[model samples]
Target: MQYTMPTIFLASGSPRRLELLKNLDLNVRQKKLPFTEKINRRLSSNKIAEEISYYKAKQAITHIKNDEILLTADTIVCKGNEILVKPRNQNEAFEFLTKLSDTSHSVITGVTMGIPNKLSTFSAETKVYFEPLSKQEIHYYVEKYKPLDKAGAYGIQEWIGWSKIFKIEGSFSNVMGLPTHMIHNYLVNWQKS
Candidate 1:
């Protein structure tokens, strides 16, 4: 019998994260967390994201071997002072999209890397500006895209993003879900140091 060292463990179930990592050509494993608590908007978005990422990473650590690196991330959308999480239903998704239209919001993604006794955590924030959206457009997107599983009720890689996003002020991959460039740089350096 032989054992192969796993490259990395992705502590998330998000298809977007998996896709991003795959795009980077990184060999990784996916580990889903059992419970995700709703983040309190009263806390800073950066803090909330980091805390959640740490929690998820800790939960996944038990399942991974000490030699495998575990990675976890948490993303959230903030408009003004409000933090919009995944919608509870269609109506909430519609409402969230409506508010996001014709406005500027910030998307924050926190990432954690864990290896045995070592853990590193960081966060990336991207400012996204949206053009004014018509009522029909919002409705159509909500019904068509079914953004209930997405934060801010939308995905930057989707139809709305292609047509409505006017500008992005940070890492585009961060907006997608994971900050691949940052992660790649960190991992490369980690391997070297």
Candidate 2:
């Protein structure tokens, strides 16, 4: 008898998600998708995240195999009713940092795991409180790290998070993007069924 492992396909281009998946020790293949998602303003942040995650899966539907597992995720930062997306330029990054400083915000990551006949989607929310930051520190992070590609102009694993984040109320990995514990829980059950 021969044993085989399941193939996992990551339908995202995020280096953070890739790194987290690697930490999980799974057989994964990176397939970057031009995953452009639009927000439906009528929905809440959590629903928005899950909708985008499922959309990514729908967009990649043609490429997934029945024997392989396809995982897609989307993350967003929101305060109250406003959602902050990826910064397109330095000024925006600075503004995002300024807005996030000295406040508690929500980091929501939605994940969709697809198999042969089933597609499951869920979202994880983390409350992050940032210490009051100086203008110099905010400027330094925007210039040095160039957080243009990250949502809310920040990465939890980066210097800004280390220096400014005073408290985090949920999974740290969720703030980083992929929610490793959630995925691991799903994967363990996935392997059995």
Candidate 3:
């Protein structure tokens, strides 16, 4: 059979993901799905991200054409087994960042690539170490960054990430929201087959 390159459909509202894909110079289009991540506490941290991506992919299936593949993802922060998602308000954002202050946490980005007959899912995990943040600093970030839209009340590419993050032990882009290296490898190899 002849292989035809599938048009890429990005099913996420995150500007970070959009920029990452665009930066890679991939032929991609953005269409956000109704995917507010609903966490199942029973699952592991990495599994939570992967499962949410699967749900997002399923929701986006209707928008995909026969010659297109839908890409969806969910990112979460894990401090031990506790999962921190997007905050609902500034106060919550305050609390989330405070908890992450001066500690090591895992940022997991789960991804799904859905085609006509198959769905492939995987997750990338990055270990991020944060410096001790003062109350004023946390408040300042919440006020200035408006981090309610981001997972764990923070964006690794934003001010807090630049200032407060001390170290990262894995894919930097994964902490930003998408794992570009992994995604690129998949796109390259997937296109080949």
Candidate 4:
């Protein structure tokens, strides 16, 4: 008998996450979830990520087949007590970047994977430190990169991350949106079981 791995259906719109999975040599199919991401301001930054990812996974599971596993993820940036989600406009991006200048922020990514009634969830955190960014530099990045779609109004793989971010204390892939190391391990163990 030939055994085959179950198909993984990625229920996220993030191209970066898809790219990371592909780079890790995983078999994945992207499926956009109709669920809209809504943050609960009452939860802690870490809980917020987990809850969102869980809800996303819950929605995606309904559409998956018995031979497929649904995967959902959410990433958030926290500066001090503030949770910085995707910027609504250019001005908001500038504000977010300005606040991140010369400070450390936490990037938390929550992941959920499962079939029908069974599920597994986890979160990875990365602390990113930024060098002092001048007003000119922040403005330039906001205009050039147009990071309105990214949480914290920045992409860790972009120019701002290259020049402004000085250090990071955790998983790089977590900051990018998915914690591939953890995901890889989970997938391997699940296949063995």
Candidate 5:
């Protein structure tokens, strides 16, 4: 089936995801979903992101027009079996950073895309390696960045990532909460369909 390019209604409040999608030059519209996001710990670390993204997309279906696709996404940080969600406070942010110090963790972003009643979901994973973080460094980052709104209590494009993150594998955009490379390809193929 041949399809024309459609406007994408982004049903997320993440500034990073918005900027990432806008940078791609897609016809993007930001829409707010009326729901509080919750992470289900019963899911494995890798599956949690996608599941939440799917839920968000389903919730957004009512707001989407027939010709417009709704996009929703969720990001999660995982260290071993533990999923490190957004920190609740400065102390928790510090603790989360401490746990991530001098170690490798996975940043997984799950993206859902389609019009109402029809959606597809996928996840992108990035392995990020952080250099050992000192207490002072972690404290400074928590106080200055105020990463309470970001998953993993940190943003890869922020100061913490600049100073502490030494290496990464996979999409950098994925670490920021959207996988642009994958999203670009998906949009191209979807438009063709």
Candidate 6:
């Protein structure tokens, strides 16, 4: 079978994901999905991530052209069985960081890609370890970085990433909210199909 690149659309509001996609040199359009953003409700982290990605992809389908290939993704941070989503305020950010410090957590990103009738879904997981953080460091990070928009109260590509992240055990991009290598391979294979 022969493959041809289709017009690409990214169904997410994450600037990090956008930047990563741009780094790949693919001309992709961006579309934010309409859905509620709430974590720690009652669903499993993996289930929530997949469901959210699916919902986002479904929403994007309504607005996309038939020829445009739509891609949607959702990322979640999991510590043991608990899901740590984006903080709603500074206090939550503080608490989240304190709990994550010196511990290993998994970052899961679920990705969906489709064009009208054809749809595929996959997810990537990365384990991130943070060095033990000081109270002063946590306070400074929260106040200076304002990480309310990021899951686990920090960005792995930001100042915190440079100073705090001790190690990572998977695609680094996944920790940043998108799995570039997996996404690229999926896109390349999808185009072939």
State the lDDT of candidate 4 residue by residue for 1-193, as single tens digits: 8544567889877899999988777678897778888999899888999999999998888878777788999999999889999999999999999999999999999999988889998999999999999999998999998999899999999999999898999999999999899998888899889
TM-score of each: 0.93, 0.94, 0.94, 0.94, 0.94, 0.91
Q: List the residue pairs that clash in candidate 1.
A: none
Could you tell me the TM-score of candidate 3?
0.94
RMSD of each: 3.4, 2.1, 2.7, 2.1, 2.5, 2.5
**Which pairs, if any, clash in model 6?**
none
Instruction: Name the top lDDT candidate.
Output: 4
Off by over 4 Å in 6: 1-4, 38-44
Model 5: residue 70 alpha-carbon error in angstroms: 0.5
What does candidate 3's lDDT look like per residue over 33-143, in tens digits?
A: 676668888888889899999988887888887767789988999888788888999999999999999999999999999685688999999999999999999999999
Q: Please, what are the lDDT tens digits per residue for candidate 1 over residues 127-188?
A: 99999999899999999999998999999999999999989999999999998998888787
Write the number of the candidate with greater TM-score, choosing between 1 and 3. Answer: 3
Give the number of colliding residue pairs in candidate 1. Answer: 0
Residue 146 lDDT (model 5): 96
lDDT accuracy of residue 86 in candidate 1: 93
What are the runs in model 4 whose C-alpha is more than 4 Å off? 1-5
Q: Candidate 2: where are CA atoms >4 Å away?
A: 1-5
Worst 10 residues of 4 by lDDT: 1-10
How does model 6 score by TM-score?
0.91
